[model samples]
Target chain A: MKKKRALALLLTTVMGLGLLTGCGGSGSSSESADSKDAEEGKTLSMMCIGTTADAYMEGYQSIIDSFNENNEFGVTVDAEFVSNSDYKTKLTTLMASDSEPDIIFTWELGYLQTFVDGGKIVDLTPYLEEDTAWKDSFNDGMLDQLTYDGKVYGIPTQECVGTMYYNKAIFEENGVAVPTTYEEYRQVCDTLVANGVTPVALASTPDDAWLVSQYIQQLANGIGGYEYFESLKDGTGKWNDDTMVQAAKLFQEEVEAGYYEDGFTGVSGTEAEALFQSGQTAMYYNGSWETSNLDNSEYCEVSEDVSCFTMPAVDAENAYISMGSVDSSYAVSTNCKNVDAAVGLLKYWTNAENASMLLYDYGRMPSTKVELDQSKLSSLCIDVIARFEEQKSLTPWFDRVDTNIGNEFNNCGVSISNGEDPQGIYDGLQEYAQSQS
Target chain B: MKSVFGNKKSIAVFVLPAFIVYAIFCLFPIGYNIYMSFFDTNLMEKSTFVGLNNYIQLAKDATFIKSLKNNILMVIGSLIAHMPLAMFFANAIFKKIKGAAFFQTVFFLPSVICGVAVGLTWTFIYNGNYGLLNAFLGAIGLENLQQVWLSNKNLALFCIIIVVMWQFVGYHMIIQLAAMRNIDSSYYEAASIDGATGWQQFVNITLPMIKPILKIDAVLIITGSLKYFDLIAVMTGGGPNHATEVMSTYMYYQGFNILKYGYSSAIGVVLLLLCAGSVVLSNKVFKTDDTQM
Candidate 1:
């Protein structure tokens, strides 16, 4: 019995030591491995949004691989890809922990502004100012969204605008032409519904609230124009503004009119996209980033017949005004050991050759000027590019403008989709906005 | 060795490691969270002391209030399903019913699955379009009854609660069954000889004997429901305009999504208090003394 007690005591001590060693070993080994990598050469870590589901992931990987192989600075990059849905939470957690990757994929405006406020991002203004040609390469105002307090914090890689993608075969079968006016858009929906087809495929799940909210913003853009969007951004406009109310009412009307697929409020983004791809819905309104997905034969049964046009203007005078913003921007984190190498890698990524490749092959619209080879682009990409060029103004999504108000707007959008009273919803949002200010 | 067992120093040696770990990972976080509840911060930036403002705001915050109500409903729903219903199944199984082992495994299987996996399976089953529930309804000529289970704000929380009930009823049943098995068979045999019906035997011999375990199971069900997160997070994500938002998910939304860490911490403190309160309340309700066992 005494021996058994001694054995048990010995086991307990061993277990305690094992736990202590387990904790200490992991920390020390990782530190050593990082130092070893640093001594070999600068190793920049990049985290971007890309997963197997995204068509352009290959293009993104190729850019990283090429940069790693050919950079003149002897810097190597280790990249990690997270799916878009999980990117924001993952990035924010990393930022909070001060272990953010050297380079991070970021959205413009308020999303990046939070990190800037936290002093977690590297200021890229000096780098941009030092290279006049590179600065000039980006279109005017492209960098403005990422500029905070006169310092640029990110490099914009692509420009995106929302467009209404439709199945040509479905439209033709129903004898409906692409709508060019707000009235025509409603009529088109009516016609589709009368023909026993779902008019639009939309996802309204809480996780995909932005998918529905962006379309509502597009409608608001048509009704209130870019000026209204700007006023909302600067706090001069109320969420309950007449045009905003009209936009919400119209969206609700559309939802009630069976303009959207059945039970769309529960549908996930991918599921809604699949519904349209499978030829069950006539239209899908989303960012041009979806061009590759819509046109990919592997994912879409209607890929060959997929085409797009901008949603028609609510007021014809404000025609071509759309909801859009800079997409796929990269920012250097303050945690980066080699800022220059990271910036150089970003520059290489947005260079003319890679920009053209991304645009032609993956349907990413380059923020920088690149010669378009029309022959190499999908027809949908060409149409989207043409629409981008024709846009009178593009308003960014509300969530990108201000995280607090934008999130409220998205929640309101979900409620609106579920047949809630728009006046009550907007009143609550307006009250919250005022309270925040 | 006997002296070592009686010695406080040896006992401390055995307990200190686990106690230290618990303090670091659990107690410290709880204390830090309470301290954080008094500040307005994103945690990365310097925090401003906000006193009781976060708690005050939580009271007025419509979504938070809704979540509190949802959480209460969840607790009630869980209690109703896990107690009497579980006891009924446990008693049935304890009588050596036919196919007892098969039924036992069938009932307990869901609780063994990961919460996220169960949530995902139920999500597919409750899907609005191609979901099994709707398809089944349609096949029965009740197509009009079909509605998006997770999207209908009125039905969404109840649907999730049903899944939670389905997932854990068997688990509670197993707990109650174990307690039933611990009861002396001689008591039941004596009651039978005294001409007591099965119901009488259950009330006199079974329930009183198992009261101590029931007290534990009650606390588990109540506290478990109060702190529920994974299934709700994986299912609706407090969707359809925050109709399904629970306190835990709201805390996550505030802290992670909106970067309101202080406010999230306040929510955390409230949840912690509520969970602790439920345990106390359950203990009082059960009132089974240790000596009774």
Candidate 2:
């Protein structure tokens, strides 16, 4: 009996120690092994926002492949792509648990600020100061958006702007010109409706509420210009301000006039894009990131006829103001095994070779300056880039600005499109926004 | 043998392994959750102890209140379908009517399939543009009645509830059917000899015998519906302005999407309390002096 008790006690102690070590940080036992692996560099992990279905996923992968082929760090790169809808939540949870990938795809402004404030992201300003050539590769304001408290934390890889993509064949058939003013835009929609064509292809499901909200925000940009957006960003603007209410009212009027696809409230984002791509609708409004989808001949039947223009200003004095921002930024996590190796990968990702490849093949506009190859560029891609250049001001998505208020703003768009009273919705949103702060 | 079985020390030795596993996996997490609910933490920084602030905020939150109401409606919907409707089907099968075995398999089929698959199948069926439901309505010349099935705020939850009703009614039927088969045949023979009708026999002999099982089944249906997550999560995602936001989905949204771990913990605690309250209420409703129960 004494021998049995001793065996049992010993077994339990071993089991308890096993459990304790398993729950503890993995760094302790692996410390020596980690240093040895670091000498050979390591297998670096990168998380990007795109599924296999996205056209740009190919472009992102080729960049990784090329970097692996000729990298100074002896590290091999492995990539993980997450679907757009789930990426934000997945990244945050990973950051909080201290298990995020070495490098992560991020949005600009307040989206990346959450992790910076939590100290899960590396401050890359000193590194940028060391590599001025690489720092200067990005556009002027692109790096500024990812900077916080005078420190840079992420690198912008591309630029995107919301543009109105129209099917030229449908417009020509309807005998309508590209609208340069809000009234002319309304007239264009009326003309398409009279010709028995759905005027605008739009989606309003909660999953794709941001698409609708962006369209509404674009209208507000046209109405109130860059000053209004600055006011909101600086905490001086209200959710129920006249400019916002007016924009929503115009959207509601368009709905009543049947200037949008019928039964559009139920349509999803991809489904709405398909309507324009297949020529079922005259126009689609979305970000420049969709140029690849529009440029594909196999998927888009109206590929040849697709060209874009900025949505005409509601108030002509505010012309050229648009909804856009630095897009597809990358940041090095504090959990990274080697910040230099990760930064090297980021530099490779945004280099002229990869940038031109991404732009020419997949239509992802480079954040840095590069000579245009007209022969390789799609007409739609060129048009979108030109329009992006002409913008007087670019207001990023509200959700990218602040997750809470931006989400509520998206909900407001869904409610408005569903025929809810805009004034009441915005009023409620303002109350919610206040409560959140 | 008697010495080992009767001794408290030996009993503890036998039960210790299982108890330890249960404590680590279940009890510890539940305790941690309840503790976390008292703080205001996003799980990255040092959490601030806010005392009952999360619970108080949940009470005042319109979205949370909407989710609570949605959960209650789901429970009610499940009870209506899983209790009487399921019982009625079980009776038909118990009567040994023609094709009873075939009908049993058909009714039990959906519950065997996974919830996510069921949700996706129903979403395709409910698709606004090219869905079967819309196409069928159009075929029957009821074009005027055709509308978006899952996107309409007023109708989306009802549509999902109807799918839920369709999917689980059969599983509950099988449970009741098993209890029915356990009943002795002699009671019914005596009832027939006494000139009792079929309905009379069912109401007295069959029902009284199965009352205990029915009580347990009611608790199963109620708790299951209250904690339902997969179907709603895969379907609307508590959307069209959170028209179908049940407590489970709302809790997931708060915890994962919004990064409010404390608030979601409070939601979890509320869900637990609701489940416990329903179990007690059900026991009271089914109270009996019969020793067999």
**Highest DockQ scorer:** 1
Model 1 segments beyond 4 Å from truth?
A1-41
What digit string (tens of lDDT, one per residue) describes model 2 on residues A326-390? 99999998878788889999988888988999999888989998888899888988898889879
- What is candidate 1's TM-score for chain A? 0.91
- After superposition on all C-alphas, the RMSD of every candidate to the true structure, in Å, is 4.4, 6.4
For every model shown, the clashing-pair count is 0, 0
lDDT of 1 by residue, B181-219 (tens): 777678888888899999999998899888877776787
Residue lDDT tens for model 2, B89-130: 999999999999999999999987888999999988998888
Clashing residue pairs in candidate 1 are none
Q: Give native contacts recovered, as a fraction, per prediction.
A: 0.59, 0.42
Which digits, one per residue and each the tens of the lDDT, describe model 1 over residues A116-192? 99988999999988998999999879999999999999999999999999999999999999988999999999999
Tell how far residue A250 is off in model 2, in angstroms: 1.3
lDDT of 2: 0.86
